[model samples]
Target: MSEYIPLKYYFDRDLALHLADLIQSEYPRFTITSFVESVSTGVENKELKARVEVIANTLKQHLPTDYEEALAILLKILGPENKTEEGMFTNGYFLMPVAYFVERYGLDHFDLSLHAMYEITKRHTSEYAIRPYLIANSDRCMTYFQNWIKDPNSHVRRLVSEGTRPRLPWAKKIPPLKNDVQNNLSLLEKLMCDSSRYVQKSVANHINDLTKDNPEAVLTWIQKHISDNHGTNPKIIKHGLRTLIKSKDEHALELSRQVEQGV
Candidate 1:
């Protein structure tokens, strides 16, 4: 059997050259060699986040200095290709650096940054990048999420739940969502019955994250929705409560019907 490489290796010099080629193809003036040069140094030694920062910093040097213009140029280079299948990660893996760029440079321009994120999400995912906006501008970011819940792209819709998770793995926590359970539930309510399983899985994971801080709240929610509208809600609830069910939380197991005993 062959050993698998860690995900961080994807950001090494090969990826830098690949991205540079993609960008230079669209914009002839792009300095591909310079971009690769800046990204290649010290990148192999860094971990995942440090590698992302290295590429983002290198991008800043080669792309337009103006954030909006730089974002536009990157989008143009990314083009309109999207994943044809649900739950596929390989389709846009190359665009992770673009998300890092948005995270690093897009804070000051919320609207433009959000628009860029929406576009980038169609190609890859801005889930990791969007968390900072949620932290920096909770009200505005929440509003954007409410609207994005209806976005046609499954990735964009998935971002609404995945990006707002209080303890999303490999990403920073959003204190507002962590501190206010109701606010998190509000968004979940809108997505509980999402048409796409891709989106539904993210919603399930978001609720599961909530369980860590407030198990009772999640239990109550599961009980209320367990039998609603032909049992779809129960499936989602069960997935969300997997941790609680495994830990033998009396109410959670009972509500999920994993046990016959009453709480």
Candidate 2:
């Protein structure tokens, strides 16, 4: 009957109902009764870690076969928050589904997960899960990215930067980006001026991650786009300059000073 119990105990009918009630309280507008029931029936209630893994695997299995339906269920279950009432939900609950969607439909059915990703990422922006969805199907994702960069929805464009992050959480590390990271900066080349604060943050993080392997490239980006994005946005300035500051690079320091002086 705990507020924050592990997934391993979901099999106990009493425990499942209690946990479901707590989650329902958190998200009164949306209900996850079916998923909770499915979890309760599954043997995942034995070992916590194993149970979570099983759920992740199950979601993965479902993605390729019946993605539209599966994604619908996932998005509905995740629900909205106060500030934004969309498919925003807890990161932990969506991890398995995200991972599964990436593995199953990332190649042939990018659209199947793309819409759902746009929704779930509003709340659970796990870098780990987003990375594979981008890398495994970079070409396909890029096709969508081409269309999304200009779409009215900032959430879609945010995925452009977020999905390609090198050190994204729970995802495998892409060494190519990590090594000559600057090469990958083109992914967000057009997103620098995205109107959404959330989308802009993802753009900044993309630049921040690149700085580790390519300081010069990041510097060039900042300098070239300085007039365009430097002074106006805090996220761009901060994330773009993170590496230079961390390395104590001289030019970066000068730029920081300039931004400060402008302020």
Tens-place lDDT digits, model 1, residues 1-263: 97887878888889999988888877678898788878888596889889988998898888878888888878887766476534234657778889889998999999999988888888888889998888788889888887898888888888888888888898876654636888888788878888888888888888889898888887776666554542345567778888888898888777777322221
Global local distance difference test of model 2: 0.59
> Judged by TM-score, which candidate is best?
1
Model 1 misses residue 96 by how many Å?
Answer: 0.7
Error of 2 at 237 (Å): 1.5
Whole-model lDDT values for every prediction = 0.80, 0.59
Q: How many residue pairs clash (N, CA or C atoms closer than 3 angstroms) in each of the candidate models, in the order given?
A: 0, 5
TM value for model 2: 0.65
TM-scores, one per candidate = 0.90, 0.65
Which pairs of residues collide in model 1?
none
Where does candidate 2 stray beyond 4 Å? 1-52, 59-108, 119-130, 175-183, 227-235
